[model samples]
Target: MANVYDAEKKVTVNVLNKEFDLGLMIDSYGNTGFRLNNGVFVMGPMAIFSKSVLCWNVRTVIDITPESLSAFYLLEPKLDILVIGVGNRGDKLSPQTVEYLRSKKLGFEILPSSQACSTFNFLNSEQRYVAAAIIPPTNVALNLDEEFDAGYRRQRNLRLYEE
Candidate 1:
């Protein structure tokens, strides 16, 4: 279903040849942030990636309210899970928003921005029904799967050392 590039360690699915990539990572950023996918740039604090990218003019993670996430309701049929990238670190959501997301019965994984990007890419490449809401992290350069694996290994090593 998906073409796996073992040497490059990236996966590409043959859609309409338009390339439905959910982007790789935050290519460049500033106080305001941005995500880069296939040379297309997105400027914002929050963005939802489905069949297309929905960039939101948010300032911080706290701005993500239930009302702001109404778009996901419409995408319930298209995506089975919605992964949220919580900036450099994870943040707590308002109970109202959390409840609303839960009520929708969509699987959710809240992770750091890099991890979220990695997960989104993996799912998207497999052509799975998935989407992501991400807050771009600043000053971080990631090479999708490689960076993701390295990060995971680093975290794992930390845990092992701690133990």
Candidate 2:
């Protein structure tokens, strides 16, 4: 596997022989946090936007508030959607926070960290005006290969135990 922390880490997508920089693309993630396409490995939770990445103070879904998300509200050009990654499992935000976003006319999607990462990457690739507030999962596979192998092992173990 390539060193995720290497300063040379970059993944580009080609479109008609022209490569575009996916600066906000999440290259990898683990308990510590995420490795971005720009080769910056951010620790702890983070708020990712198209132009910048900020370290978030939130540790759990319960820590999420409109106050915690003040940065998103201040973004220029506005955001089409905000993706909230609620750690290892899917969780709901506080009613107050939900109401706050709605009142601001901000659309959002709450999902597990894993799914949120993928969704954010996809939207970013499409050049959509999107942002993400992510809480790193305490236990997670660092890459797709690891995730697939882990799932396959789990299924095999389950069959063996059942038989």
Please name the candidate that would achieve the greatest lDDT relative to the true structure. 2
Deviation (Å) of 160 in candidate 2: 32
What's the lDDT for all of these models?
Answer: 0.60, 0.76
Model 2 alpha-carbon drift over 4 Å, by segment: 1-20, 141-163
RMSD per prediction, one decimal?
A: 11.9, 9.0
Query: All candidates' TM-scores?
Result: 0.61, 0.72
Worst 10 residues of 2 by lDDT: 10-19
Candidate 1 lDDT tens digits, 65-141:
77777776685355677887767664666788789888877788778766776677677767677777877654354
Steric clashes per prediction: 0, 0
The weakest ten consecutive residues by lDDT in model 1 span 8-17
Error of 1 at 29 (Å): 6.9
